[model samples]
Target: MATRRIISTEKTILDKDDDDISSPVAGQQQSSNTAPAVPMDVILKLLAFTFAMVVVPIGSYFLSVNTFFKGNSTYAGGLAAVMANVVLVGYVIVAMNEDQSDQLEAKKKAGKKE
Candidate 1:
């Protein structure tokens, strides 16, 4: 019977001993457990837009299929596509507004510091 030995040269976290283990790597500073780079409001806004993107298209498709289009699947599909684009445009507009507001706030803070 022959035995095969597998050798790994890489030093993974699991392979490190207690003495060799360290939190921060060389020349890297450890950050404090403070607020994230993205604000909660920004996260929520993105999530809401994402949810709308998913739900709006499907809901419009089903609602228009029988209600407005009179079982015309082609028109219903078109409306669904249009609704998706509308949602995308809405998200873009909201993002642009938020970006502009953030820039304004940054300028205000800078002015205060000076």
Candidate 2:
């Protein structure tokens, strides 16, 4: 009786290809080439600028009214001024929160790499 040996060239080549696919070399270059995108801080700055632009006009209106009336008025003008300032404050808060969230997201992404 004679003993025969079986060899698989296809299986060996497939195993080699799989090893190369799983290696870190292929993914490293791709990840390095493409970085994550981040929104510009200029957008937040523009929002704050817009808020200031709006607030200034409203404030000037209140100041003019106060000066014209010698600081005397019914509750309406005062309420309006307060409301305008409150709106300005809200815009500021929103801008700040957006900036903070962006920073946090960037930090989280950085942490993921480590």
Candidate 3:
């Protein structure tokens, strides 16, 4: 009987391109606490996204709706697309509001702690 050994040629490489401020790495001093900045960044990103999605479609809808599509149900695809955009913006704003409330709750908890 002969015993055979199996070897993996794949090398396990850990990428350090991602910087986690919470994890203190040896030989390097991490600067001030960056936790507060994260929520603000997320909020700003959402706000920008919300405005882009809402404003662009609205501007184009008005610009083309008058000259292009005459009736609402005349073309199924055109009407469906308009309705879809309206529903999408509605859901996005709901999500944005939820995130805002969650951030407020986090701030309240932090305030209670201090």
For each candidate, give its TM-score against the true structure.
Answer: 0.71, 0.39, 0.36
lDDT of 3 at 58: 59
Where model 2 places Cα greater than 4 Å from the true spot, the runs are 1-73
- Candidate of highest TM-score: 1
lDDT of each: 0.91, 0.70, 0.66
**Order of candidate numbers by lDDT, starting with the best:** 1, 2, 3
lDDT minimum window of 10 residues, candidate 1: 12-21
| Candidate 3 structure quality by residue, lDDT tens digits, 1-114 | 999554465333332333453467787876777567556766876687677666766565665565667644345446546755876777677778978999999999999999
Better of 1 and 2 by lDDT: 1
lDDT of 2 by residue, 9-83 (tens): 545667889988777884575445464464566566777768766776567567756676666655546655666
Give the TM-score comparing model 3 with the true structure, all chains together: 0.36
Q: Model 3: residues >4 Å from true position, as ranges?
A: 1-74
**Candidates by TM-score, descending order:** 1, 2, 3
Model 1: how far is 89 from its true place, Å?
0.5
**Angstrom error at residue 26, model 2:** 24
